[model samples]
Target: MKRIGVFICWCGSNIAGTVDIDKVAAAAGTMNGVVYVDQNKYTCSEIGQAMIKDAIKEYKLDRVVIAACSPRMHENTFRKTVESAGLNPYYLEIANIREQCSWVHKDKEAGTAKAISLIRTAVAKAAMNEALFAVEMPITRRALVIGGGIAGIQAALDIADTGFEVDLVEREPSLGGRMAQLDKTFPTLDCSACILTPKMVDVAQHEKIRLFTYAEVEKVEGYLGNFTVTIRHRARSVDLQKCTGCGECLAKCPAKVASEFEEGLVQRRAIYTPFPQAVPNKPAIDRAHCRFFTTGKCKVCQKVCPADAIDYEMEDRLLTNGYGAIVVATGFDTHKLNDYGEYAYGKHPDVLTSLEFERLLNASGPTGGKILRPSDGKAPKTVAFIQCVGSRDKAKGNSYCAKICCMYTAKHAILLSEKVPGSKAFVFYIDVRTAGKDYEEFYTRAYEECGASYIKGNVSKVFPEGEKLLVRGVDVLSGALVELLVDMVVLAVSVDARADAKELAKKLAVTVNEHKFFTEAHPKLRPVDTQTAGIFLAGVCQGPKDIPETVAQASAAAVKVAAIFSKQSLLSNPTVAEVEQKLCSGDMSCMAVCPYGAISEQVVEERRGREMVTRKIARVNVALCQGCGACTVACRPGAINLKGFTNQQILAEVDAICL
Candidate 1:
């Protein structure tokens, strides 16, 4: 018989005042195989630890049961103490008398009885305990950054500077992402490309960085420390090695499509570059718009190119690379403003999305840096920006803050004043949220120094008036109806998850919240960590974040990856349950019910060797078992039981406690 010792902690009246500790200890002492039952003021304290060690030595205890706080709090402490005393740490268990019993229960009798039952359960489990250990895996020192936006660029540069190899991937013809589409960044009023393109070039030239543009991450598989990624190189239809990014083919292509890079304000050729300052100096062709793809008749791009760069036969190539760690900086897409019919977004020529406005204000944009109204090609005298267009609305199904709208809208207001000189600008917002460092000051400066009007309400509707947009809304603060006829209306749309976010998450088997963002291990403590081991999330893909916060979080994820690389082997808790095959019957009931996939059926022969077909009971995969004990209750034949928490040990403890 296994000798078990029960230690009930008073926890300085945290438990004893509500639970009768003596009654619990006395009941435990009379149990079969329970050699000793003792009560302590604090079981987790050093003195209380010494009492436990002394009792173990005296009673020759094979298992220990500490009736005190939740195991989440003190299980590790007691386990370490047992390990230090040259005993198997997994042979210890804790009864959560403090939080689960005494603190929650008011009555003395009920609390005491609950404490006794808890102690009995722990004693029962401890008697069947077995030791466990963690398995470490080698980490690759390289990292893969999945976006070319500000956040991804910042992360790539930081990790490269740390003497690590980084693979930077982008789905566009150019390196700069949505941030490049912006004319100016908020609050500080820095030119978006002026501040960002330099880093884009840095990434292109960095020896430690491998930059991939017009390429997409087709698939990501394997765990952290060893991840395999397949990248699809879209047919650029141009020989990148031969063409010097000379403007020859772009000038000759006959087919023209609306340039999405310019927010559909201008037309681009069939073979075109994203912008004048595109990194890698390469051009991509629009396969759908190219006449050659439709009829196989046009060789205009090839005939015009001085350097033989156009390859009609070029096929998409898939390249696979192994990465040690991955930072998912996939970024976000702005909600299509056309959904809000009240805004008259697509119906009116004057109404534009915020991105279109950004293009209009850009020097390299369709209007050549002039903020012209689309209908009349005239400078706007007054412009209205609608904030939270599709954010913070349950009906729209986006209930969380988009986070960057308030600041960007304020910046748009400031820019409109600078662009038109004397033009009036209005920002309609449900709530002005500026929750970042120095962010509030920026919003305040826009109001006080920029001379923009900030209205506290949402815009109800918009109607066209020949060349202008008539905006109607109520100012909630003043309780007054407000109407404004503006030359242009900018919709500060919400940031939604990328279309492939859910699909990618499913492939990785990671959990995503309702917003379709990857769920973190914890909100505050483990922000960069995902529910899966070795994988980390960064930038707007996890949630909407500005440059500063995204960089900080990206750097944090890099640090975590670096730390994992520094370790020789990974360590994990070994206190997981195991099954005794000799006692197990061929019942498949527990196998079907286990949530962790820890239990599985295996073929085994009985002692009689009758060659009979048996159900072959479930066995726990120790490494994956989280030790939730769900399998123990699912066993109809009493075959499945947790190694450290068995039926015999518990029933003996209960019998002794009642006596």
Candidate 2:
């Protein structure tokens, strides 16, 4: 029998306040194989760890049960402590009494009873624990970054500066994302393009970085330190080397389509760059709307090209590369407002989303920076801004606040006063959140100095009253009806995780949250890391965040990649899937369910009644296995098992819990 030690934690009254720690400790002492029992105020502290180390040596404890917090939070800490005491790290089991029992149960008797049961289960599992070893895998020394937005660009630059090779893939024809669409930033109100374009250029000129625009990650395989990625390069239909960006093709193209970068405020040529300051400074043919590709007749771009760079027969190509790590910074998408018909969106030409209004505020916009209503070629003297339009409303849209809305709305109100003198701005908001540094001051400047009115309410409806908009709502603060007649209405729409975020998550084998944002490994500790090893997340793809926070996370993810590349080799997780070849039926069911592609079929010769016959059996590649235990459940013969969670250990724990 294994000599198991149980250490219950008071967690500084977090657990002891609700549960009877002495009763739980006494119960642990009476459990089978629990040779020693002790309690600690904070089991994770350095002093508490020393006590565990001394007890392991004094009592000759081979296995330990810690009645504390979740293993996800402190499992590695306790494992290292146990390992330093000359014991296998896997020999330690963490029973989460605080979160599961003490925190949930207010009754002292019930909480103590649950804590005792949890400790008993841990002791039973610890007794059956076995020693496990980790294997070393070689590092590839290269990194891949998905999405060429500010986050991706910043991460690639940081990694490249660290003297490691980086490959940046972007789905759009240009490197700039939603950041490029904005006219100005909050607080400082600096030109967004002026600051963002320089970084975009640096990414293009960096020696260690290779930029691949109009491309997307098609597939991802392998594990940490060695990942194989397949990228699909969409056809640009213009020779990158020969094109001189002379704007001849853009001016000559007869076909016109709504410009995406301009938020569909104006028409652009069928073959054109997203913006004039595009990183590549080149134009791409939109085959869906191109006259030559659709009708198969007009090759006007080819005839008008000064460098003869237009290519009519370009096809999409697939290329695969090896990367040590991957960073996802795909950014976010704005709410479509399909369900918000009450706001008169898509019905009135004057009613616009925040992004569409941002384009109108730009000097390069369709009306040359004039805040003109789309209904008529005239500037609006009065405009009403609605905050949290599809945000913080469970019935309408997302339940989380789009963090940048309040500050940016204030910025819009201030900009309106500066751009058009004598213009009035009205802002409707439930609550103005100015959490960042100097954010509160900037918001105050809008209403105090900029002659902008701040209304405290949600707009109930926006109806088109002839050439103007009539906004109707109640002032929640004043308990009275409020109405405004304005030339235009701007909806401060919320942001959502990219529509295709979950699709990309599946490809990388990373998990996403209920809101479709990529889930971090740990929200507090591993904010930039994804659940998958060697894969990290940055920007709004993880959640709604401002540019500064996104850039910080991108740099943090770069450091993680640098750490991986700096290491000669990494120790693979010891607890991986294993298969018993003797009981193998070669059903290949385990291989089908494995997300990591860790399981494969291998032929082995076996003796059956003195007859040597070759049979195919499932084999597990430890380097690729992440110990998810999916295959163990899928195997009908029960031959496959995860190392630390074998059938015997789990059944022993179940029997102990029932007792």
Candidate 3:
């Protein structure tokens, strides 16, 4: 015999307007084992919960069913209600009548019938529910942060400040990411390096932080609170301990290649630091272009080094470490302008991407902050800035706004007018999205005070004519064609996911959206959390965002990692799979399908005709099992089963529904 109580919610006419609640409650009372039935206007409210609690006490109910909204919305709320009433939370089951029946049905009679069936199905499942307990696991008080960009730096610094060990890994030779390439930030017009370099220095000086530049995450294993990670440290060819920050080796190297930090706007020696102010300020040999590696002829860098720090035979190293949590802030890359051939990006020397122009504006750049035309070493009197070159265009396959382009474009225009006196600046845009604090005012100042022209349209084509370039487009506002000849053209390209973003996501066992950005656990509530616990997301890797947003998210992710490290132990999910040793055949089929590698084989003793026999059987590790139920289905025999979602309970619910 079982004691059951059924409660139906009107949801303040949200459910009652479509379904007859009174009839459904009456029908529920007739169901076997249902000792009491009641209806409430808002079952999740405090008063409604009181009524259910009183009924459980009055009827001595052991099982309870709540026919309310979707279980995703209120399952945890109702679980707490049952636990406070001195009942096991597992004894409760919810029937989503609002979303599954009432909301989808038009007729009252039909909706009530469907709701009654749903309640019956839930009641059947609750009658067979079993009590389960969570398993306690130990925690590791360490964190791993991927990417050495601003977001990763912020997260690592915050975590290390809380007295926990943190490892910061970057694939590049330098710590400063894209922010280091920029001349100035938007709105405030602060020097980018003035703000970013100090933080980079802080990371180097932090005692609890371990910096691993020129390294990448090779493999990840284990789950929340305990993860084993293997890192691949790429060879730098220069001894970090012996190398000094002198410019002798770089100046003496003969081989040169396009500098990646400068967006290919200038060339750097084969053995050179990414930037002058690079953290550690040490140079690494580019083996691909190095004359020594390529031809075994030039050892100019090795001979020029005063400390003899250069090594031609350095090998890549692999180191494995353990951590409690991980924060991913891999960052983003600018869209390639090959699809926008009309912009003449690769065709004309004067047409430059926004990133290229940013380097041109840098004080340490090739032009020494003069903003000279690349084709000719002369300053441009008239400069044209184009917006949405690879963004907000369906034909180009990218419809999402790059989010920071409009503000950065405005900053470029403002700088062009101030740097070159009497310079004419023309900006062509579809819409100026200045939606940040003081951003609109800043965009307005570019035109009002700076004497820049703001046009409303997309550039159709850019053609080179002598020293100047001709930009042709139609002004959507005036319905007239417009053409402008300018000395330089800067295109605001779209921001996209990094080239290896998807591959990294697979290695981490995290989910990414259609556009390859890492997906969050929840869009609004758990913005920094990933679907995989202990792993978090930060910065533009999650989506397109500005500096302020990236910093905020980075700090939020750090707080989450700190919270995990604060705990001495974590409780594993009780609904994980369990194995019946007597029935397991040890075929190892379950091990093949398990994504978490929770299933394994072990020897067990079984009695056969009064004689003890040692046989192999499958075993389940509850700590590693995520309870996806893939192993249970793969088992040919009924040897494995999920704790709360047992086969008997599911079959009973099916029988009740069919009846």
Per-prediction TM-score to the true structure, in the order listed:
0.82, 0.80, 0.81
- Residue pairs with backbone overlap in model 1: 27-656, 27-657, 31-656, 124-649, 124-650, 125-644, 125-645, 136-569, 136-570
Q: Which candidate gets the maximum lDDT versus the true structure? A: 2
Global lDDT of each candidate: 0.82, 0.92, 0.91
Alpha-carbon shift of residue 71 in model 2 (angstroms): 12
**Higher-scoring candidate on lDDT, 1 or 2:** 2
Candidate 1 displacement at residue 202 in angstroms: 2.9
lDDT of 3: 0.91
Candidate 2 lDDT tens digits, 261-346 = 99888889999999989989999999999998889999999999989999988999999999999999999999889999999999
Candidate 3 is scored at a TM of 0.81
Worst 10-residue lDDT window, candidate 3: 591-600
Candidate 3 colliding pairs: none
lDDT of 1 at 184: 82
Using lDDT as the measure, name the better of candidate 1 and candidate 3.
3
lDDT of 1 by residue, 1-659 (tens): 88898888999999999999889888889765689888899888999999999988888888888999999998889988887776888788888999999999999999998888887767666766666555555567788888888778887888888888999889888888888898888768789889888989999999999998888888876666777889898888887888888888889999999997888889998888988888877788889999999778888989988899999889999999988877777788888665689999888878888888889889999998888988888989899999998899878637888889899888888888888898988999999999877889989988898888999999999998766889999999999999999888999888888878887776655667888887787898999987666677888889888878887888887787777667775554354556677767767677666644456678775656756554566677664465667777777667776655556756755764564
